[model samples]
Target chain A: MTGSEGPGHQVQAIGNDEDVVRVRQLVRTAAVAAKLSLVDQTKVVTAASELARNTLVYGGGGEAAVSTVDNGVRRGVRVVFSDSGPGIADIDLALTDGYTSGGGLGLGLSGARRLVDEFELDTVVGAGTTVAVVKWAR
Target chain B: MERVPILKIGSVLLVSIQVDMQDQMALQLQEDLGQRIVDTGCRGVIIDITGLDIVDSFVGRTLSTIASISRVLDAETIVVGMRPAVAITLVELGLSLDGIRTALNVERGLELLARNAEPDTFDDLDLLGDPETTSP
Candidate 1:
């Protein structure tokens, strides 16, 4: 589908494994428009890609949202990736580096959080997971 | 994914990029690879990115930093097997890899290093003086 326009942009896609690439592209476009530096933009996109992949691989399927925020002189982008798969049982253990559930390095959540200016995570044992990431222009 | 072994060849270390070398893993790998090069006392490093379909900014910057870290340890670093699409995308995305050296293939990169090590070929250059002018 096509991404929305204006100060706030949005796009929705399936949580399939292939959608991870599209989410990255979307993050790149939104972050660049928000005036993030190339390195910062890449960081955001990479984090989003990881989260999206996790949502698809572990969570079964999910949705990703992107929006630009302006608070006075401060400007940034916020990405919220939500999924409806088996939720994380231990957030603390999952956040640890090198502890992976999907044959990965278990750096997805922590690494994604590190790349952004702000990070938040919400999950229910039997419900699902939602990860929010925010990166400001610097 | 499985953790691939870091290939060691004499004074050089060669690593094949795995598919999951993204996000935090990418960052950790960068640091680990840099440290390993120093710990091994290798003179050179080659990171083969043949498995990667996309090379984002974080990966690009990490690779560049690894190259610099290798230099700090007196080891040379070379990035090889970057797909044309990935290369073009990195340029389009405005990611600058200033201190990094790239090669089309690992073999060519190794050959380059070998050539640099031995540049003196007797047959390549003629004698400075003519044969008649030389002392008997």
Candidate 2:
């Protein structure tokens, strides 16, 4: 029952610093439009910020899609980050906190996972990674 | 290449980051702040982040790095004007910003620095470059 889409779709390129801020703003706007609370907005926006950075730094740049979803019972905001770059060799290890190949906090994947109600990850080593996250209304 | 203004106030340096910020911009601030520490011979630093709506991991790490660099430069870094939502978000993001001092606002931050400045022997200002060197 996830056919209902709210507002519309937004696509932003994540290749540099400016894009990262843009993606965060985009995600926050969609979350607000979905009527998410201030705290929820901050959480989703923070997740989007992390994922977008990963897409740029780790994934070697990509694109993000922002959309609102209505699952018949709950309204939610979703952002899917796709990038074609050297993918994660071990998803588990990559998700582990403090494990970073780029000297980051390594909280991008796991922390983002915890911030949302639904998370989907797809990656193939030497190929790319796609992360989709959604925060539903409370 | 936007430069975050690092104000030289008496014995303390005040910096207020008001932009949404780019990675390079944050790096630039880090570099400029380090240079300012050496050039101004300040003993303390206070970074105000009230204008920032979000402090992602990148910004969080930058702040931590700034604090670390300042400590090594014979100066202290105190971050102020952190919103409650941003704080929660940082925590949920698994970043504690360890070892960074903070205050409610600029006034409190200045007060903290002022109190610490008394009997402050900033004699070893040369430690601004050498992290291995420590002096009170």
Candidate 3:
């Protein structure tokens, strides 16, 4: 898994509890590769956990893909969670805190957004949801 | 499927989550803990997370969930050994871990639980063991 292409770091399944752990581990590895500090690594990993769980529980299953980002001198890690399921109806409401369609603290979206340096989300009602987050080394 | 051993010391249940747990494993631990609390009649629960250098909202909520559920079953929970980085991340991530008590280490967590849940248990250490001779 370590010997891969430049942008391809690690990809893991996000269908169950075990998969969530794998996602966290893979994100940590990517964070390390990006030379992120300990705090940054933890924040990215935590955000990854929330997003992965959201993929599994809400999206019915997805794949978490983490890769390294290098902009000349600075390096970063980006994680993308893509799922094909019943897509969200309202993007604005979904990103709002205390708005949960399922049983959770409703922090999956907003809380995860706060942990990363960059966050992007796309959802089509009949298609699916794709959330991408990036944490740069500091 | 992986089990974090639950040890019953006197009337307290102690578990240190030192493994990289999957989602299923965490849920199993929760169930096992609830059952152990009922079976042992333990008055207190102390979980040590000194081994976990990183904790996300999922893990944080798991700890808080266990604590909250244990309260319903008449058991007090004290989570100890959270790394400073994890705490800061948790705060930034918006997980306050509300309604859960925390401590610095296992010894302190145990003391906190005992002091609040069963003050007499510490006073009557002789009942569990001759502490002067056995445990150092």
Candidate 4:
């Protein structure tokens, strides 16, 4: 998975629980590499865990890419979780705090958004879903 | 499939999770705790998470469920040793972790449980002087 990715990007498969843990570890490494503070690292890592699990449970398994980015003055870590499963029909509903299709707390998407500096969601009804989030060093 | 070991301490059961638990492992801990609570008739359960770096919604929900299950079995559950950062992130994540008790560390958690170990029974009420004899 790492071979096909760019030089700085680390891609990991999210097929099960272990993959989710690996995703979190990879994000943490990238976050540290980008010089994120301890609190920021914690926040981003927690967000990564949520998104990775969503990719596995809701998205029926997928992959995550962790990359460090630089925006001139500041550096940051960005993680993208992509899944080729049943795409979300109601993005807003899925972002609701208490709304869940899989008996979870339903806080994965919304909570993840709050944890990072930038949050983006791209999805299609039948194709799949991709969630990207970035947390910059402070 | 690594299991979280549950240790017996007097009337309380202690589980110190020193692993980066997966979702399935967390669920297994919940089940194991419930069984231990019944088998030992423990009145309190303390889970130490000082070793964990993060506690996401899945693990948080499992803790809540375990607390509820322990309550149903007449046992109190206290989660101790959460890092400051983890707590802040959890609140921001909109997970209040309702119905779950927490303490600063294992020692404090034990104190909280000991306070609830003994209820105010009829004997204790009698010790406070009979109502008829102590009438104003």
Alpha-carbon interface RMSD for all candidates, in angstroms: 8.6, 1.0, 1.3, 0.5
Cα error of candidate 1 at position B111, Å: 5.5
Better of 2 and 4 by DockQ: 4
Better structure of 1 and 4 per lDDT: 4
Residue B16 in model 1: shift from native, Å?
14
Looking at model 1 chain B, which ten-residue stretch has the lowest summed lDDT? B117-126
- Which pairs of residues collide in candidate 4? none
Scoring only the A-chain of each prediction against the true A-chain gives TM-scores of 0.90, 0.96, 0.93, 0.94
Clashes of each: 2, 0, 1, 0
lDDT of candidate 4 over A33-109, digit per residue (tens): 88899889999999999999999998999999899887767888889999998999999999988889998999999
Q: How does candidate 3 fare on TM-score? A: 0.88
Candidate 2 lDDT by residue in tens digits, B20-133: 888899999999999999999898999999998888888899999999999999898999999998999888888999989999999999998888876454544453544556
How does the DockQ of candidate 1 come out? 0.07
Candidates arranged by TM-score, highest first: 4, 2, 3, 1
- Which candidate would rank higher by DockQ, 1 or 4? 4
- The superposed Cα distance between candidate 2 and the true structure at residue A88, in angstroms, equals 1.8
Candidate 4, backbone clash total: 0
TM-score for chain B considered on its own, for each of the candidates: 0.78, 0.86, 0.83, 0.88
Give the CAPRI rating of model 2: medium
lDDT of 3 by residue, B1-136 (tens): 5699999988889998898877777788999999999998898998988888677666777888999899999899999899888888889988888989999998898878767855665657767787685688
Clashing pairs in 2: none
Q: RMSD in angstroms, all models?
A: 11.4, 5.4, 6.2, 4.2
Give the runs in model 3 whose Cα sits over 4 Å from its true position.
A1-8, B118-136
- Model number 4 iRMSD: 0.5
DockQ (Cα-based) for each candidate = 0.07, 0.62, 0.56, 0.84
- How much lDDT does each candidate structure score? 0.73, 0.89, 0.86, 0.91
